[model samples]
Target: MSNNDSIKKTIIVTVLLCIVCSVIVSAAAVLLRPAQVANKSLDFKRNILSAAGLLEPGKNVDAIFNERVVTRVVDLKTGKFTDAVDPVSYDQRRASKDPSLSTNLSADEDLAKISRREDYSVVYLIQDENEQLQKIILPVKGYGLWSTLYGFLALEADANTVVGLVFYEHAETPGLGGEVDNPVWKAKWVGKEVYDEGDVAIAIIKGSVDSSSSNAVHQVDGLSGATLTSRGVHNLLHFWLGDNGYKPFLTNLKNGEA
Candidate 1:
């Protein structure tokens, strides 16, 4: 074959390959997106129920969430409450570009660290019947030992005490830092205080809890060897719930402004 003809044939083949690959990817996305979204919503509901002490692995999470949970969204900076926007559908990477919804943070903030771009965040507020607030579940993510750890933080009605802690996604080692998901360790966080007197006081100590301590924070035994992972959780919690994080919103909730 002539060189010119050969080159033209190669170009045609390359173009065809690109088209075929694109079509396959698009088709797969179309077929899977719905199921993916449904699973995501169900998992989110399950996490919310778990944080509220209602999740049973074998039980119906959808029914429990539907019956007991009331979800609301709030502007973190202005501390103003708002109606629910679909948390699962709201994309933070896109929302961050909207100046009204996002608060400015340093280079070190988790949202800033892993984010390709910063945007407004979605906060899920869960309340029980009688209009009594049980736990304020915040969507939080941060760098862990190996990857970004995404989880929910359930703060008690006081907005300082911790009701429950659950990490629904992460990449830490299974036996060590991954213990953050273990029921035994997470259960220890049930009654802990996330802050003290407006100061961030919660910590994950390397050693055992000292009974002589007077702080309201509950002590969870750290993993036998996952020091870095434990510290990552400690720092992530302190950073996200501190001055640069959700403190403003929590303050408003405590004062009845929210």
Candidate 2:
């Protein structure tokens, strides 16, 4: 073949090789996507049940979630019962336009780290015999050591005291900030009151609680060397539970709305 013809042949070969690789990758992704989704859903259900103090690992979560958990969407402003919406499908970025999901945030609401405008947040209301609500669980997500931490916070009927707090996902350092996931440490959060007479009272202290005060704030000692991670959790908790967080919704729940 002539020089130009040989060059052309080489270019054609390279192009074909690239196309074949791309097609193979695309096919593999398509084949694996469903399994990835299933695994994610199964793990999410497990974590949610764990946060609700219902399930242990290696246990069946689907049956328990179906039997004990009731999920709902609410108007944040009115704090009343509303139509059901899927939390997984809700677009937090486009939530401003959802007429039923009332909020003070305008169309220009900051699309920050977490999607603020979710059509509906996942709320797990646990029940007991006589069909009465026992624990009210709400999802909490905010910035952590290196990324946003997503977890669950279960509150007592009073809406002020926390019943349990558990972190399901976070990217903090393993030996330091990641201690937020430690069961022994998180257990301290149980029975901790979030606020004291309209003021934010909950805190993660650097050391042990004094043990002298009758009503000392719930204190989780900071990881010895993880200042940033500790600070991140502190800030996020305050931000999420404040007036802008779930304060309004929780207050209404306390008032016997939903």
Candidate 3:
């Protein structure tokens, strides 16, 4: 056989092909990163709009978001708005992992099962044409049955009534835990009250909410056959709305101090 047809030559050719493929893939990834980041940011803003019921079909997400939403950073400890961090670039999830920017939670204090909580959170505000607050969308996350569920919870101007909710990311049993994505289940969140006399009264039950019950306004039907995921949702909501979470900030918002 010719030297070019030898096994050594074949191996050299194969190695060269692999190296070329790798280099091409690396270059493509580098070139596409900016677009990827932009798309991700757009998707997130779209999710925020959808959570607040502001998303319209066939409309430009970026234009509608910029026109209707204002972003602010809140000090979780003081429940007050702060300029310490740039609201536009601050990332709560990333901050939560930083020791200086977050606090470690004890078992009893961490109902959401998130080990560390960020000191400040980025909150989105929807306003009327007259500049009055219409809705406040807060980002929340916690451990679910198999993965962490990240989502937004939008409250009305009163800060007690639910406007809407939508999870942007999660991995759970498709028919069970993943039912959180179901429109019927999500619609149930609308108009529910998050507080009863300064207490976080919201809950997720094993079955459907009883409209006739006095407590119905605070209760939501749990995900069928996904008790843990349902419980996680309840816990995360509780944590985010409680003292260690956005409660202080929300109080400030209610008092017009935020």
**TM-score of every candidate relative to the true structure:** 0.79, 0.80, 0.97
Where does model 2 exceed 4 Å of error? 1-14, 84-88, 92-120, 215-217
- Name the better of 2 and 3 by TM-score: 3
Clashes of 1: 5
- Candidate 1: deviation at residue 252, Å? 0.8
lDDT of 2 by residue, 1-258 (tens): 699999999999999999999999999999999999888878777777776678866667888888888877665545566666565675543664565553444333322234344445557788786777778887776676698777888887677777887888889899888888888878788888888887667787776777676656556567667877777777667755766666777877777766
If candidate 2 were superposed on the true structure by all CA atoms, what would the RMSD be? Answer: 3.9
* lDDT tens digits, residue span 2-34, model 1: 999999999999999999999999999999999
| C-alpha RMSD between model 3 and the true structure | 1.3
Cand. 2 Cα-lDDT: 0.72
Clashing pairs in 2: 92-117
The regions of model 3 sitting more than 4 angstroms off are 1-5
lDDT per residue for candidate 3 within 65-96, as digits (tens), equals: 99999998888878888899998788888999
Candidates ranked by TM-score: 3, 2, 1
Which candidate leads in lDDT? 3
lDDT, candidate 3, residue 76? 86
Model 3, position 241: C-alpha lDDT score: 94
lDDT for model 1, please.
Answer: 0.74
